[model samples]
Target: MTDPDGPSGTATAVPEPPEKAAGTRGRRRALRHPLARFLLRRVLIAVLLAWGITVVTFVLTNLVPGDPATANLGQRALGDPAIVAQWRQDHGLDKPLPQQYLIHLGGMLQGDLGVSQQSHRPVSQDLAETVPATLELAGAAIVVSLILGVAFGVVAALRRDRLPDHVLRVLSLIGISVPTFWLALVAFYVFFYRLQITPGSGRIDPGLQAPPPVTGLATVDSALAGQWDVFASAVGHLLTPALVLALYTIGLLTRFTRSAVLEVLGQDYVRAARAKGLPGRVILFRYVLRSALVPIITVAGLAFGSLLSGTVLVEAIFAWPGVGQYAYKSATTLDLPAVMGVGLVVGGVYLVINLIVDVLYGVIDPRVRLQ
Candidate 1:
């Protein structure tokens, strides 16, 4: 052949294009930062999961027995073919399923969540108003649960087989086994109806108007606006439902934390710390608790995410104007757009919580980020 191999009988190496080489170098540089790599990986996974959520919600709503146009139009409007057709066309329900889905996805990307069939307002706007309320409730619940759960868990672990441990274990079992709805009903009856210690249902007293909507959380907004009376009212109104919602999570975290601390207690390093003659409190808090934090954080994250999404029954019972209530209303009314928005919000909550947990893992234990 015409000396294709040249003098050394070896082919020449092909040089990568400058653009390709730059991209490769950029990737390598990005990878060198463990935290950055971890964040990027987590973010990509979250995005993928979000996409799957959209797909699943879309398909399920479509498969469900109901026509959006008919549901929104009512019986009188559905009697008019022209009105029905116009409504379908206006909502893009006239398009092919694939095209409709693409349009829906595109609108979601652009922050347009469609118009709520029930409210006649933008779905995004409705969610914005409701989500903050749920956040406040869920936030309060998580704080209460974390404090009680961690304290009880540590005590249980320390006591091991003593009477305190047995009592706490029984209480936790009751908390876990009891249904939230029934507990909520009983708590509401005993606290609000019988004892009258807590205020009646709703976020605040009807007499005082809500403070300016800086945060949409009544307590926060009231405090920000220097409405101390309103703030106190908001807190009182919030306490009962929040505590009711927290019971299950408190139990779950208590059991899990006990296990985690017990596992850490068995580690060689923990034994070494004890052998070093450290104070009992110091050894327990400094070594066992610190090492057990990663698992505790994981459980807490999942519990918080569940609380945020699973508050429908509690919200309904308490008359709390929150995302859970909104979702329940939408589902009952067959408001598909609002339902989808709620689905997205719930799924996004889990994703964000998981990302936060992952980042916390890296922060608490540097070894986690290396993977």
Candidate 2:
């Protein structure tokens, strides 16, 4: 740069080195990558949230009336002070609350979820064995819900005030209103007892040998192991419970999807597309549905996350050996470590699903990325 008006002197400006400029540009690019920054922020927040959950769960579980040591000892050892004291000491339950929490947190960080007082096995191991069953059930339910819900929603939106729309609305209301436990029982009685169409409560037929456990998801593990008979049996067993779980979610998604699609259909671009003599199906799907998907996706993700944690009743009714069932058992027995483990796992699952949904939002709508 030259300052011509100052002392009649000419000044030369030196350019920054190319490597330095390149490095700055690289840093900027890294910072600008939408998902990288978004994921980093989300992960940091998740870490803090997870720690908070652990602390709260620990405190609350400890505050329950019955002691873990007493619960572990059962009625036989309840009057025996020496045995109960020894059990507390052995399980570190006799320590101060703060000390116990610190110990628990440290062990959690090291992937040790503590041994279940009832099972005498690691809580982590129990979760590993059970979580996949819940995942399988939830995953199946959500898939069914999405497919049926979106389809019904689109049809309802297109029909608007027609008979089909009215019928779907009524059906959705019933679906939402019906209690899951009742539905599971009714389905079991009708299909399994009377009609003998669907298999009874279990992950597989009793007589048939189960496929070797690979993923803990019977249907998946069976298929992966090339056990066709096991796969069929598992699918039959999974359908009723998964469908029962799906019904409520289906209602929610259907209502939300219909509303979103209707809103999108009323938008200027969608109207313009229709006015341009585009094929009705093309305009409906390409313009209307695509525009409507953000809210639908958001609801779906949340519903799926909720399903993952809220399957206790369904799992119990169906006798599905999932985390929800394990959680129920743990809670009932006042199994502190097992309950805490389930809480942490469920919270983590919800956080992860939300994170994925947020990333998907940016992908689906670039404006979200900028925001």
Candidate 3:
């Protein structure tokens, strides 16, 4: 301005300084909605946690008693120093532990899970072939768990102190108390051996020609390939193990859901909805059940994650080719790289599931989003 005070004003309106203008733009660019920021924070934390888990797994595998080279080469090579040395050098086992860890971490980052000492194939490939099997089994189990658990829970809640509630409670208690391995064995004995109603073991009947390995999940791939016989066989083989794995989750979810629904039914809003001439079923489903979903979701997510990793025994019992079975073999043979790979994958699964649950929390309850 030519003068600090003009005729029409005490001071002419000064244009914002370039620095101030740029700063304002920067702040505007930096600002993000609360939900976006929250999600970003969670993702960062999950990444860090996954890395920590990998490191711990690596260290623990290294600390194990057996030498990987010896495990790989066996006693015959143990007698030959040259062979052992060559094996160690070839696999990078000759390097220092920290250097090995770094190399392993780098390879993992690039999606190379290293070669299996026992199988002599890419660990990632092995997991790729097996993980789908586990996923299929776990997926079936979860569906069963959710349907039965929620149904029984709702029935128990509705009937309160009736005979059906008592019977459900008793059954849930038994389900929780029974060991998974024992259940799997008993199921096999009763359903497969004695009754012969289900297939004995494996993912499909050997007599049935398998469909092309499209998804590595026999049932899904067979269905996709229009191979109904293979699909039927896969389903028959899967039923027993899936049911066994689902039982524990069903019990836990049933009890939790029952308690949660009971608590919600006693709430003021639920009673208010009922008093306002709302249909009983509508109030129960829309108000009571929706309010009770948070805990149920939490448990379900955790259960699915657990099923992914904890099905080793069940997989072994059922002879299902899954990551759990692979992990078992690797651990028994002290295959460090394979074991480490499984650990990373399992831990990553758990973290990812928890992240999903957290996101669901925000979606289901807007208050969580605002926070």
Candidate 4:
């Protein structure tokens, strides 16, 4: 029905069809699901946490004993006070605290991490180059932790107080007790120096130069460059650090998984699963494994985050070039910007990994999405 007063297109401005209306409502409801809401909240929190990390790092790094510019001058610029002061003014280090914060925040928002006084390179570039190496180490460590840790945990749960369980308990305790630096020292010395077998330290052997950066990770970049020999050397270098990191994490992961799985194993669902005549492997792997996933994921995320900051001793011991090593060097040398940058990035990783873990909760347990 046309109306003379109606605007443009259809004179009556025909209403949406009821079927289409229902479809729109359904789509809206799906978007408004609890999981969707939870994920949205997690994202917001992560952003806030990242900002907080940046702020804290910014403030603390500046709060160090010496001024950024003056300290940067060191023995070289000791003769030129006026030049140092001019440099400080030019870098905005002489600005008021609030102004400095604002400038830093603006820089961050623009993805500019600013320059590192020590390296004379932009912080963003330094991070972009260094992070891949750490990530490769982290990835390998996590893989080892997840595989061996979860496997041992399941074995302990299944075996209870048997020899396997007892042996693992001792191993876990020993792993937990071993200092990172100590383990790394022993591993390096015995394997590299004493035995004269494995390559002692660094990402690659002395004579073997890796192909030009592809992934920035020696192992990955080597593979990409079709240098399998370099990749193999990288793996060997990776073994000690990965094992050290994994051993420490494995104890926590294994113990947590053991308890979680053991708890779920006693649940009625397991009995019902058994009664249904499902194979033992199927029941354990499907029903039990699914239920235990949340706790396992929790530990894995924590371990991964810990590994980022956790590598100082490992890197120092093995001369591995990583973020942890950078932080350690920065701290020892009073390179506040580098130290703070590492802290901010590491803290941000923790926040992001935790968010990812929370998202996994919905995936591993559908009940999280029901509400």
Per-prediction TM-score to the true structure, in the order listed? 0.89, 0.89, 0.88, 0.88
Q: For residues 1-371, what per-residue lDDT tens digits would candidate 4 score against the true structure?
A: 12233333542377657786566556567657788777877798888888889888888877778655655676667668888878787667788988988887888788777777678787778777777778888888888989999999999999999999999988888877887778888888888889988888889997898779977889878898888999899999898888887788888888888999999999999999999999999999999989998889988998897777668778778888888777776676666556767877788778878898989997778788565
Q: What is the overall TM-score of model 3 with all chains considered together?
A: 0.88
Residue lDDT tens for model 1, 197-289: 989888999999899999889999999999999999999999988988999999998999899998999999998998899999999888988
The alpha-carbon deviation from the true structure for residue 251 of candidate 2, after best TM-score superposition, in angstroms, is: 0.9
Model 4 stretches with alpha carbons more than 4 Å out? 1-30, 33-35, 75-80
Better structure of 2 and 4 per TM-score: 2
**In model 1, which range of ten residues has the least summed lDDT?**
1-10
Better of 3 and 4 by lDDT: 3
lDDT per prediction?
0.89, 0.86, 0.87, 0.81
Question: Taking the tens digit of each residue's C-alpha lDDT, what string does model 2 give over 52-155?
Answer: 88988888888888767656676878788998888888889888999999999999999999999778899999999998899999999999999999999999
Task: Supply candidate 3's per-residue lDDT for 274.
Answer: 78
What CA RMSD would you report for each candidate? 6.7, 6.7, 7.2, 5.0
After aligning candidate 1 to the native by TM-score, how far in Å is the CA of 208 from where it should be? 1.1
Residue 261, model 4, lDDT: 91
